[model samples]
Structure formats: C-alpha cells, structure tokens
Target: MKKDKPKYRQIIDAAVIVIAENGYHQAQVSKIAKQAGVADGTIYLYFKNKEDILISVFSEKMSVFVENLKVIIQESITAQEMLARMIEGHFKVLSEDHHLAVVTQLELRQSNKDLRLKINHILKEYLDLLDDILQRGIQAGEFIEDMDLRLVRQVIFGTVDEVSTTWVMKDQKYDLVEMAPRVHEILLKGIQTQ
Candidate 1:
C-alpha cells in the first residue's frame, strides 16, 4: 500500500505543518510537497487531492491516539486511574506538538461541511475509546450505574477537546499538561457515583 512508503509518512507529517501554518483552504499541494522534499506530483501518488491530504492528516494523527487509548484501556488499573491516564496522554501528545495542536484545533474546524463530516467520522474512533473506561467505572461502582453511555462519551470527549482547543486558541502560552489532572478530577466528579 502507498501508506507504507516512507514518502507517505513524510508527506503526512509535512502536511500537518503546512496545513497548520496555512489554513486548509490555503494549504497547497506544492507547498506540502516542498515541505516533504518531494515533487508536487508525488503527493498525488498518495492522496486524491487537497481534501484527501487534509483528511489523511487527521486520520493519521488520530490513529496514534486511538491506539494509545487501546493500550491504556488494557492496563491493570482502576477505572479512575485509566481515565486520568487518558487525559494525560491526550494533553501530552498535543502539548508536545504545537503544529498538530494548531491543525487539529483550528484548521480542521474551519473546513467545509463534507470535510468536517469526514473528520468527525475519524474522530469517532477516538471517542469510542472512552466507552471502555466509562463502562469499567460503572461496573466497579465508581460511576453512576445508570450513566447514559452516549452522553457520558460526549461529555468526556467534548470536555477534553474544548480544553485543548482553548489552549491552542490562547497561543499555547500556558502548560496544557499541567491542567490534565484538574480536568480529570472535574470529569470524575460529574460521572462518579456519590
């Protein structure tokens, strides 16, 4: 598959920087190619068009988060500890990569309808990771037994997403990782059984 080629990963990483620097609409195939140190036509080998490149960037980056969450879910820890790790991991990844944070939080949101739909589809995999932790919490009598899975998922995702977006919007002047513990605590309070 084209994705296995080194250039494919290079283009994907370069695309993030290009798209993050120049919003998706303005990000050009040639710019991404230049950033990847490849010819413009080389991008076409891996992606259908500019839209494909943008969506692929999201898909590639989010896959890492999904895979990491999967591993976190399997760890032998309390549900609350797992949730804490998830928040910390999410913040750590974005905080360590300012370009990715800008692209995911700002550029992606400005895309057109169809692009947003595709991005949302990719996002579901990340959101679904929360269900395992939520269910575990309920089973352990930590979270409210009657918790609505969908709503709880939305709450967890929306909260974490908004926090990251806000940090990105603020020019990332503050430390995002430092806020993870508080975010975890706030979320736990809302979902945990009293």
Candidate 2:
C-alpha cells in the first residue's frame, strides 16, 4: 500500500504555525518538517522550495475561502446583506484561526516583493467576490452609482484587513466578530445610497 502520500495539507498547516511563530525569515524547511512530524525530505516531495510551500498554502486556503463566500452570498437575498455577510465571514475565518491570521498578516507581508506579487495574484478571487457585491449593490441602487468599483473594493477589503491586523497585533484581546457591524457601517458610509 502506498504510504498514503503524506497529506500535503498537514505539512501546510504545520508550515502556517511554524511560520506564524518563527516569522518567515526564520522558518526553515527543517523546522516545518519537524512541526509536521515528518522528515525534512518529505517537504521536498510536496513542494519545490520554501516559497512554493508558502504560495501553495495561500492558494489552497484562499480558493476554498472564495468558494465558500460565493455560496454564502448566493444564498443572501440582498446585496447589502451579502456585503455584511462577506465582511463577517472574512473576519470570522481569520480570527478563528490565530495561526493562519498571524502568518497571513505578519509573516506573509515580510516576503520579498516578487513573492508578495504572487500572493496578490492568488488574492484576486477574494477581491473579485467584493467586486461582485459592489456591482450588485450598484445595480440595486443600494450603493452610489458614481463610485469607482476598484477603489471601493480596495477600501472595503483594506478596512476589514486593517481591523483584523489590529486585532491580531493587540493580542486579540477583544472579540473580532463583534467588530463586523462597525466595519460594515464604516465601509457603507462612502458607498451607501443617499
């Protein structure tokens, strides 16, 4: 029996924890392998290099995130509600997974410019979800028609991202979910119907 190809996901999860705690610069393949309870050689089997592991982690987690968001938004009756749900969902996921949040918000940002660009590409799906809601809100007349979709999308995403980062930086003392309504309200101030 093929020794069930050591789940790459398990390695990735271990990488997230290791990277989150050690910071990207200090995290090594050997450390990740040790965290995952696997041999150092096992990592090379699943990834070409450390960078590949980082990118794979983001791609795998983010793709599922986008898919789940799409499904949730589809079930909602109104664009405004969908936007609120989206914001809440985004914060909920990050806040619940403290390791992933630290890796994404802090360690990932420490990556070199080229890797950052690659990560940005992986983030497009999530951004597209926001753009979809913004467009829908515009069509429904719930949001301002004059708004620049791209800029508004950035603002909305940036706002929630900042909130999450602050929560993480402050040792996550407060409940992150509770901030959802306030974040949604602040975002709406610039886009909501007059």
Candidate 3:
C-alpha cells in the first residue's frame, strides 16, 4: 500500500535515527533506506545525496523549532519570560528526542567544513530569535544597554548547547529541564540591569 506522507520525510526521519545510532560516517544511504523500509533508490528520489539528507534534516527541524519558539515568545509579555520559555522549550525538545539530540549534538557536527557552514546557515533562524529577545530586552532596559547582542546571542546559544551536549554525553541521567532556570540566571547576570 502507498503511504500518504511524502517518502522523503520518511527517509529523512529514518536517516535521523540511523545517523544518531551509527554516527554520520557510518550512516550509509542504504542503511537509512532500510530503516525507512524503502529501497535505496527511493532515498535519491528525495535527496540529492547523503549530505543533502543531513542538511535537509537540520534545516527542516530547525525551521520548525524556530517558528514555534517565535510564536511562544510573541505571546510572552516580558523579555525575561520569553527568554526563559525559549530555553525551556529548547532543552525540552532536545531532551525528549534522544535520536535528535544525538544527531544534533554529535553526529551532525562530524561533517566537514562545507557541511558545517551550511548547518550554520540553518542555525541562523534560531540564533535570530535569541537576538530578537536580546534586542528587545536592551531596548526595554531589562538588560544592559551596552550589551553586545551578537555576543550575547552566542553565549546564550553556546551555553545551552554545551549543557545539552554534556547531558547527552552523560547518557541523560538528569533532567535537562531542571537546568533551564539556572541557565537563565547565569545569562541574566551579564545582561540584566543593575
């Protein structure tokens, strides 16, 4: 029987799992196709190559993540509250999906310089969301006026990224969501108004 959803998405999802489990270097297209329960040729029909699949996965997942975060943050009345929720949402999503967490924190980073650059482009959407919050906070006097928005964005993203990576590397024994409050607190020190 034919599936209603597009075959490409299935293949990509399968690729996520395979890549997460086996690492990027070991995740052959054939393995991804098999995991998706489709033929090897089926993968090519959707993606140009293995790299295309990886890039597409990051782009698609990050796009959805940023879009959702934007809506949530818009509904928030305060920049601090919005920043808290964004961090919570990010850690929650990454923590809930082990495969995705592994793919994002570990496997995806194993790509060469070119692929890494492409992934960085995909990451801009999420980075922009953080930057928007920083800008708003600066304007509202909630955060310091002299704060470097770009550097602040990097610190926020990097801190959360490192925290999540450590959790994943530790086999995720602790609750990632519990760290959100502390993460927000530490970040606030640098940005908050005295």
Report, for all candidates in order, the number of backbone clashes: 0, 0, 0
Question: TM per model?
Answer: 0.97, 0.95, 0.95
Off by over 4 Å in 1: none
Model 1: per-residue Cα lDDT at residue 77: 80
TM-score attained by model 3: 0.95
Better of 1 and 2 by TM-score: 1
In order, candidate lDDTs are 0.92, 0.88, 0.88
Candidate 3 per-residue lDDT over residues 1-194, each given as its tens digit: 22235787788789889999989888999999999999999887778899999998898778767987898777999899989999899999888889999999988878999999999999988888888888888888899998878888889999999999999999999999999999999988888999
Point to the candidate with the largest lDDT.
Answer: 1
Give the least accurate 10-residue stretch of model 3, judged by summed lDDT.
Answer: 1-10
Candidate 1 worst ten-residue window by lDDT = 124-133
- The positional error of residue 162 in candidate 2, measured at the CA in angstroms, is 0.6
Superposed by TM-score, candidate 1 places the C-alpha of residue 63 at a distance from the truth, in angstroms, of 0.6
